[model samples]
Target: ARQLQKILKLDPKTEVFLKRVSLLLTQIAAGDFGGARRRESFEDRPPKVLLKDRPELTK
Candidate 1:
């Protein structure tokens, strides 16, 4: 948090800085930064005609 304050040129004692830190902490407590997002993958095979013989392209 100190590093981020330094990077943003924020004074630690100010209201704006305190509000931002509070919001960030609240978001973190709610798992907003957790790496549990869905990933993009081929749910089903691509159209056969578009990639008829390109074996490597399937993935």
Candidate 2:
């Protein structure tokens, strides 16, 4: 709507903006915005200091 476009300061990308908003709502409904999910996705790699002490990297 024109009111939404005026409020959002968008030229004619209301459809695009609506699509993004829908996706955000979907993510919220699916609990994808939780911090626990982010923490669980961390890589289980060693620290940089330990990597430097390795025999392969020391060579």
Consecutive 10-residue window with the lowest summed lDDT within model 1? 34-43
lDDT digits (tens) for residues 1-59 of candidate 1: 99887767856567687898898798789877443441223334466876778777776
True-vs-predicted CA distance for residue 8, candidate 2, Å: 17
How far out, in Å, is residue 9 in model 1?
A: 20
Task: List, residue by residue over 1-59, the lDDT tens digit for candidate 2.
Answer: 99886787855578687888998898889888655755665434545786688858544
Q: Positional deviation of 29 in candidate 1, in angstroms?
A: 0.2
The ten-residue window of minimal lDDT in model 2 covers 37-46
* Per-model lDDT: 0.67, 0.72
All candidates: TM-score: 0.34, 0.38
Report the C-alpha displacement of residue 31, candidate 1, in angstroms.
0.3
